[model samples]
Target: MNGSPASLDAAAMTNASVEVVRDVVYGHGLVHRARPGGPVPRALKLDLYLPARHAHTAPRPALIMAFGGAFHRGSKENDAFEAEGGNTSVADYCLRFARRGYVACAIDYRLVTEDPEPGTTPVVSAPERIPTSRTDVVRRIMNLPPATPDMLWRGIEAASDDMAEAVRFVRSRAAEWHVDPARIALGGFSAGARTALNVAFGEKVPVAAVVALSGFMDRADLQRHLSGFDGGPAVLLVSAENDLDYIAEATPGLVAQLRAAGLHCELLDVPGAGHFYQADAVAVHDAHGATTVERAMAGFLRRTLGG
Candidate 1:
């Protein structure tokens, strides 16, 4: 809202227009044990949502929506903000899935803090400065990490392990949530997108598909590893031309490599858009207006994950 377009607020949210009711699964937001050597301790939590009335179906698809905040900041609760409430909200997204007959889960992963103090600003011990010319400031602020590949890898590894554990935790308890363990999908915005991509391509876990929104994917070793990895899940790279310079540059090459590896991939390039389209309809308007981008994303999700 501060740095993004003003049009997003006034633009019509078509998804909000739909008439859908959902029953949320509350109190299920509990932490699961993390893999050894990951960032946060073994106590990381996630929230799950399913069509309250439709839990009897078999093999129902599930979505794991990871909130973006550069991996340093953000919570699964952020997805419930009033401005982005309703259809754009993660709850709404999952509810839409439930309405369409799928289950959705949103997870909160570990933030990159050396000594995280609750309710205090997280200070990242990284060489990179805030508001840099080389990186997207918002992303940098959210995913504040040391300016080195090793640090990034460590953060990502921790996140991947947490995410993997989350998937397994959900799968292990699939009967309770009425979800199909084999049909789980991973998706996130920005840094969360990177985590999703890493988990989907990495050998640590098995994901059916990946939906990376305004994501960055330029780790050569990770790319190389994914290139050789067999049976990796499909990917949907969603972004606008104006999303972020680094993400824009890295995604195409990643897509090319994934395709070469015989993996299923699709790139949805929105016009005139920047990062955080869901929260700001003005930015969505700036890019190609809200209707177009929302429909595109909704359609892409439906097509890739099934309606």
Candidate 2:
């Protein structure tokens, strides 16, 4: 943990005192395609991590996160270092934030390849109207590989909807969780980060802040969305120096666009790192001295969510 913040170390990253409630269903709906037998409702679930009860008496701020697997394969419990037999899963992030007095949730969304039936729509909130022109622009900005042939736009849309529902669900349970509804934030990595951006800017979910890692959006669309924006949620746009080409190219532009729109946006580029660093793997040199990705993320949440 070179250049690590004094408050952060490997030993203190995952707080054992945190309470995690796994597989908590947040939304229920039909799959995009029917199963072998018939169309059975799919329950969208999340793992909720609550901080240890303390005498400090303020409702905890909350974070709702989504996992990334290119919108096709991922789990709320997927450990970033599973191949190495390590226990650094999204739950580690949740636990770290929980210990700092924030309620954290890692959620599941409908994957692109979940059920491949044509013309079958899943039950979701009223679809947010996305202009065809905007979709075309986003496709160009993404610059995905030529090998995959399914509809990428559809997956992005569906995932964003699921994230919005998660936000609403957490807000609804604010009292039971002893959280502050107005202090909730959204975050994710890779594809999940893209989903968080969609919910924040596209779906217009009233969240306090957004933390997007290795993710970006069309600069033109971002500016368009920020038209007449009176100080929207603060944004932390993070990416690796060696991230995927498209992400490396677009992240800086998006950060510039957000700042030009007079919004509070920060950028953290992890030098010599790639797109898939674990929560605490990459270290960043910031005002707080040497900081890991998890530390940077937690600090951002605290600043924007009043933790």
Candidate 3:
């Protein structure tokens, strides 16, 4: 036996071990789009947070988290601010989902490039000065870039398109991403929720389920793109009752349509909260019960994607 210990080899140690992927695997998978004279040929960068191997192994269910900023801008990270607050970063969801036995991705999508010209109309945020119209809420959706109807519409479409690409990218790398293609799902908050719904309906892709936080889809929009995909997937709808407009105007009819169309739809409503339950969860959790949103969402995922 040698008296001296064997010399350590730094290269050998580095080569033998897999790179420790803590936090997330970022800017890896890509989705490409070719637009005529488009400013950017490549769009969207994605991040994946993997859970413990034993907890969630190969062919795991995957969910895509989209951020909301009135469709203009957002980070792919969960820590990306949720104006409504309760967000612990979409990455948190990915990590937690991975822990609970799933693979999750936070993907980027293109936003409306055109911001309204400054001073064309003075921006007003004061409670008294604010418009009491539907456009007002839409305007507030984005922190930057004064949005108009057309810009917002394009923003929604662009974001939805890129998200679809993300989904397709996941499916294309199903083996690499360790995802079960059949169980893919989409979820988002507010504007992001709208994007999620748009992806669910606008594209012809097959997803096992959807988790929409404070959002809904128009039946007409769904029908418009019905030819692209076949079959209806279950949906988990979460909302705060304090948002009267959503409760009185949208949710009831949306739920009815979901049931009428034979889609499994579950609605979780917080009786005393406002428009941004997620934000409230982050900033004023006790009053809003923001964490509950994740609990119910996880439960739904466990049931829907557990298989």
Candidate 4:
């Protein structure tokens, strides 16, 4: 909440609106984990939200987002299940950003496939059937009742690759979309945050910044995969005061590790919230005025991206 002031007034953009271009295919990639038969590529898509026509004459900054679902269930379209007015979904974030004269995208990525039933045929026998994993963040991380450390790593890698692809896809279409490719940032909630961090640090893609909400990688993973990480984007790490126990436990170490890598990182410890909330439900005061998640994010983007 405390840094460079917001570039725009948060309250004045109430009447702003945006247009959505949905189901646009960006590329194809294999799912988070290999199926019974082998790897199969799936279409990667995104819903682009552009500032309404005439909203701007020059290229605008872009924000590419990935939704959180523990790398299991969820889509580029929706977010944590809840009603926070227009503050709840991924599309909502896109709409808000587009209204403020920025291009935004909600992207698709591979998810884990459900285990085959005992004595039942697997996915290769029925490619048309949908595959799923009802696993949640807690289950995946703790490996509580069942151990799945390997599966967790594979899913994170797969999802991170897909997110990296999304960044590349947006950059490829920068001219057509009137986007400033160098200013693009990556963000996500919960599991999506984990994926975003992975892409920003692990991938070679050079994003301008990153906003991770209630998400982070394990300390060991950070040391193992990102020890050689060099210059990368500035980062804003948001942790819900009441976030999952494990995420809270890992945050300090994560922040320390990021800083140790010579990266400029800031932590926003959001009070009175958990893993998810309405976009504006939580507010913070900057020099500009009281700002919500939407405005804080916009401000961070503007400051880091120089929009």
Candidate 4 residue-wise lDDT at 9: 27
Q: For candidate 1, give the lDDT.
A: 0.57
Q: What is the C-alpha lDDT of each candidate?
A: 0.57, 0.70, 0.59, 0.69
Tens digit of lDDT per residue, candidate 2, span 1-307? 1111342333433556675667788886545563577645678888777676732457788888888666666689773633222324565677777778888999988865554222332222222432223234334445633223345556666787888889999998887788898898898877788888888887777898998877767666676667766667889888887776778878878987888877778777677677667766666643455677887887787778775
List CA RMSD, all candidates: 9.8, 8.6, 10.2, 9.6
TM-score head-to-head 2 vs 3, winner: 2
| Arranged by TM-score, best first | 2, 4, 3, 1
Q: By how many angstroms RMSD does model 2 differ from the true structure?
A: 8.6
lDDT of 3 by residue, 85-174 (tens): 544556556556656666677776665554222111111112232222433554566444354555445455556666776787778878
Candidate 2's displacement at residue 73, Å, is: 0.8
Question: Measured by TM-score, how close is model 3 to the native structure?
Answer: 0.71
Question: Per-residue lDDT tens digits of candidate 4, residues 159-180?
Answer: 7777887898889988878888
Error of 2 at 153 (Å): 1.3
lDDT of 1 by residue, 1-307 (tens): 0112332223223344222222222222122234345334334655555454544456677888777665555676564323222214544455455555567666766654433212211112222422233333544555644345333444555566666667877777778666776678888777677778767765347877888877765556445566547678777777776766778777778778888878877777666555656523432322334445345545555665564
Window of ten residues with lowest summed lDDT in model 4? 116-125
